[model samples]
Target: MIRKHDSLIHQILAREIPQYVIDERIRNILNFIKFGIESGIPANGKEDEDNNTAETSAFIRQLADDAIVLLKNENSILPLKPEENICLIGPGAVERRTTGGGSASLNSYYHTSVADALKKKLGHDVPFAMGSLIAKNLHDLGEVVTNPKGKGFDVKVYKESFDVPEEKRTLLENYSIDVSNLLLFDYDPKGCENSTYYMQLEGDLTPDKTGEYSFREQCLGTAQLFIDGKLVIDDKTKQGLSSGIFASPISSPQIVNVKLNAGQKYHIKVEFGSGMTFTARKDSAALVTDSASILNFGYIFHKTDEEYIEEAVELAKKSDKVILCVGTSLDYESEGFDRSEMKLPGNQEELVSAVLKVNKNVIIVNQSGTPVSLPWIDNVPAFMQAWFNGMEAGNAIADVLYGDVNPSGKLPLSYPKRVEDNPAFLTFKSNNGQCVYGEDVFAGWKFYEKRKIAPLFPFGFGLSYTDFTIDNIATKLDGENLEATVDVTNTGKVTGKEVVQLYVVPPKTTTAVDRPLKELKGFAKVELKAGEKKTVKIEVPYKYAASYFDVDANQWHAEKGEYGVLVGDSSSSEKFLESTFTLEKDELWSGL
Candidate 1:
């Protein structure tokens, strides 16, 4: 870092420069950067000799315990007895996917696996079976490439597509690049900021088996793969962002299956697009960064599907409670791409069905950033949604399973029974290069309620080991706000927390503008001991209960009408208490 400029006032004494040239903003920025470098903030990691200190680890694990959501529990089947026979069955049990794939992945200094967590909690060795392998059958292109240096495929960057004439094409760069997996990130092509560019990767593939070779492609913008002059993977469509923050692909890969001879040399070519004609894709709201295009490609095969299913069934029959950890990985569901389907990947559905036949005491723990279709949902007795819980995922889960903690986290969004049932289903896909939000106000829970479509699980739904009841709802007008109070009582035999949600149901307006059935106004999370009672008072501004976005006037206006204050645990659940309030005048307001 540069030393502070030898006193500015002293510089004027030597007449080196004029005083008017001083810029306070530039001076402040330089000072800040210099301070950061001199302070050694980047080297602060050295302060902690052991990254996973007991104190810090316990804090993070508690955070996970607080965040995990329990979607379903029938007859209090959770909080398993310490003496119960427990056997882990599934690839997820031992796979130890602490975080989803892609950029979110971390080399956690200390991480716990689900199998290990269970054993630690129970103080006994946990038996685990590799019921069905969650293996990707694709051949690693790194090992197959013919580069003498043993790096990556030969790559060529072009200003035009492969269809362009070779003589007219402008070559950018050509180099040998190697990849362990198919993800491509952080390649900066000069003069290509917020513009479209094409890339061709030349490689050779030698299959290990003489069977139908299938390839899948998932891209941020668009890409196509050709195998020996024939197009095997065509992903030219404008893709949606799978993740909002990371700009992941919203769609899964489209498969192309063909028979090929084993150990035969096959030429591979890939064509990628970075931008879509200056337009945004409809499936995603996030913008695609010109930074790098993540092109993930892989092959698929399941030679021993029957054998795997049989082994899982045998284990399910022997176990008293089956904790089926099934869901998508970061590779399947990430920030860049939205999933093409809601169904679980590979043969997970088949495995679940076969296991259900032999055992009814299955507790399905579905893990994903988003919802997935559960065709076997009805067959299971208990279900939980354990989102990406970081390094303490297993330990946090064991806390809920063993009664160390009660699950209180609610669903932030509705879980549709099928992807087709989503309100934006018909218009969710990008048309050309744009997505239209035609659903308007009817998004998420509002759409389901408006269309009378029942979701598998409604927004704000969660189960606790102990039960709670709400009563004694009362309301009053306090200046420009409505203050509502409700009494929440824990009636069960154990201590737990209950989220009291306050919903506002506006009266049918005399005007023609249609309104949603109800909107979530506020909520309060109350914790209590068994038989404990507490009053939670929530404040809802009059604007929240009476206002609507006036598109014609470009402002939010409130109507003078009667509004019903409905309180409940979730959107679809029965209202615990209902009270009405009246707005004396129509009010218009804006700004947050």
Candidate 2:
């Protein structure tokens, strides 16, 4: 709560600001903070929670309940009134941490894995039993290699220093690694941006300047290294980070050293590759990069299709309703990692299909950064998407499922049927040393309009248990900002929440780029009791609303034209209130 400007502690330290007022506000905020933290978990007797993440021990139970979709609730076994004899099977039935990964990945303070949560929820009412582990031991490989220039890229020889460029000051002038205080050592020369270099230690080394340097003999850089006279590593040559985004040695602790040359200074050299990465060593040679590095750290630990599927089947058979949790994990899609194939992993699809066959009533939940192929969509009765939610995932998911909170999330990207259908697939994994943005700037839903391909699940697709209706949409445009007022009512018997979404469709003109027929600009989550009615306000931007970059204009641009204001539960439904208006003169700034 203490923004830079409102930091009372800062103000008091910088200037002798009064302490009385600051002390009082501290008490108030601290009290709230304390309550918030305590409330996340079940309060011994508190009414509700107010923490950074809406989590509590009950959160696990809540998520399991809300997330557990009733794909098949035959004969009222669920809400498990007289909950029948259950045979909960599957290793996963007991522990399900989460789906998806990356920066969004978080560790819950405490978790009730699917099995633990179910057992806690159903207890003796449903007999809990364990199934076989999906996988006994799983490992994924990750590798990185560095070698001497011109000697070819191989897992041998590592040169520690690099050659300095004649034209520029030595790049190593002031580089420092914090190994210890008062013992800073100089690194090799500078590196070129967007360039790659390779270096090699021909073989073993006799310290050139050894009196004071901490020299140890260890095998590395295709050669043995010796500082002064100590051996740090032995027998191995070159080594580097293997696999994953953490390719640097900071995350890799192992190294190898080669045989040592008894009495000579090992000279370092560098070899540079144009338009690639750069490496340099010992003011003598350029560094060389290993072949492509494979990063599968996350996938290494994932359960196999057979393992996960087997687990799911067992879990499904034991419950009144089978909540089969599955989705695209981090390894499936990433920013730098190019996907080799667009189809769902063979085992993943097989797993879901197999689970569906065993459980007549099955709920399929998917997690992905972007959309993935869902060939089993038609087989599953219910679908829930829990995107990369933050630390509050366990509790948040629980809230929505138990009717404590309503599901109001909507997809922001289109889910394609196949990868081959994408416009970027042709040049995506290119080796020409260049990335060709062949599709210009039109991406996501916009590209679909250009290619005339319908997505398996359109952007803005999400379902709600309760029904809602949109009535009377009125548009109020003020140059760049557009405000909309619409009346919404819960038409179903149960209470629910709905997202008020706004979309803009630019006119098809010579200058207008092929854009999505409609794009999500802004949205609001609104809740209503059954038969309850309320008018909600939403806003949209004109030219300033272009969030996806457009390169041609060197600026973000939205064309001045009539725009649509849509209010509905999802993109596919026609059950909405909409109106149109034109931007005749005023223009929103180029947010490019």
Candidate 3:
């Protein structure tokens, strides 16, 4: 190892970095630490005051409620009737996936699952089934395992490895953790920050149904699982490469099947050593190493995909209405890696198809942060996009389904009818460690409109329970900004919100440069009561609304020509109310 003084990189950094800059950074860090300590903040982030208050929670619920987009609602199937016999089916229904995984993941104070929320609203339990398994890894055992006191898990930390004798090992700390998906990237125990450590977790599992249970273990370090004091999985010696927590290259989960009995308590123990104990060769892509470790283990009762689908179909056949909650969870659509395909994980498509055949009164609610292929789009009468909404996700979704809240959220991005329709379909992945921007300016709604390809749903597209009309459009130049105003009336019998989207169509240029047919410039959302009219005004800088970057001039240029302004609810041209404005002379400028 090279000393700091002898290292060339360190020498250069010292020479280039100013002393005051370094001092300022250190001072800021010290001040932050002082504030945290003085404020009596808990290191574990479990303080009572840290939890969301009633008001904050309500606000979060409202945001989630408004952000849900009603993509498709035919025959007014939404706002489910109270008397409808509803059945909730899918893996997402039972999973409390409030957020995505990786850095975006967090341990919420509490969260309600869709199944529980629906049950509460109905005043009784509804027919439910796990139609398919979409988890890329084993399911978390946090909800299944408990300690002697009926708690999550008992954890014991040590400075020595498992190879050391029990009496010789030095105990470092002991605590209780509520979850099995442990990401210890920021874990810094007293006196153990720079040292290798080991942990032992003990828990008891009682299954409700007897079956062959499958347990899986994956770790950034080395780990072993024991059930009833028998070694079930040993990931310490041999390991396989896969992306783990923090995008680190770690072992692929090792699974073992054990026959378990119903209502019979089983003793569970796990021994884990820090990354220093890992014997695998260092991978170039691995981010975490000796400084931290991650351990994710889970278990589930073994069942075939066909059996699960059959059960859901049976429930759908008997119910008067079905809410099939299907989509990718954190396991499939997290930050670590890009999804290889656009289709739903596992046999979810099959489950949706099967359910639709049995019952036509079905509503599909997809909870995903990104787009997923909907093969049954034409078949389903109602569909919704519920992105990963934090703690109040279930409550918000319940509100929309029962008509307590009107969904006004519009699609932020266009959904391609097929993956092939995407602008970057041919060059989406990296080639020879270099990615080509093949699509150029044609992206999202721009690409769809330019190619005249109809998307599954256009950007800014959303359906409301009530109807709205847009007319009397006008525009004027306020200095360098163009202000567009339009009269909106809630024509339906109920109150609703409408988004007024403004798009600018630039004049056809004789130059070789090509541009999008039309581009969205500004938008405003307006809420109105039945038979009420409201004028909404949207303003955009003239350059921002009508200019394109001129490569030769190295600046944005607004050509001296007529520019058309289109106002509508979505990107589809047929729905737009058109008007025109002209610039007397060309304008060129740069910088914010």
Candidate 1 lDDT over residue span 1-592, tens digit each: 1112344557667777566556765798899989989986794343444667889889989888877788878787898998887677766675555677656675565567688999888888776655565534243454456544454578778877667986888888777765424454455566554456677777877677788766766665577788887987767744434432354333345667878788887777777765442123543224344343556665644346787678778877788888888877766766545678888887888888888898888888777888999987887888988887878888888899888998888888999999999888899888998999989989898999999999999998989999899999999889878899999999999999898998888776637477788889889888999999999999878787678888887778888888888898998776658898988787778864
Rank the candidate models, highest TM-score first: 3, 1, 2
- For model 2, residues 451-492, the per-residue Cα lDDT tens digits are 678877666666666678888888877765777788888998
lDDT of 3 by residue, 1-592 (tens): 1212334346557687567776897799999999988998676785565457898898888899889999999999999988987899999898877998777687787787898888888899888999998875567776668986677888889987888997898888887777888877656567664547899999998899999988888887899999999999999878877765455667777988899999999999999987766666375335543455778898877888999999999999999889999888887776666777899989999999999999998899999988899988999999999989888899888999998888899999998889999898999998998999988999888998888898999898999899999999999889989999999999988888999999999886525478888989999999999999999999999889978888989998888888999999988835688888888888788975
lDDT-wise, the better of 2 and 3 is 3
Off by over 4 Å in 3: 1-51, 148-150, 185-190, 193-195, 242-247, 283-292, 510-512, 552-554
- Compute the lDDT of residue 194 as modeled in candidate 2: 22
Clashing pairs counted in every model? 22, 69, 0
Best by TM-score: 3
Question: Which of 1 and 3 is ahead in lDDT?
Answer: 3
State each model's C-alpha RMSD to the native.
11.8, 16.9, 3.8
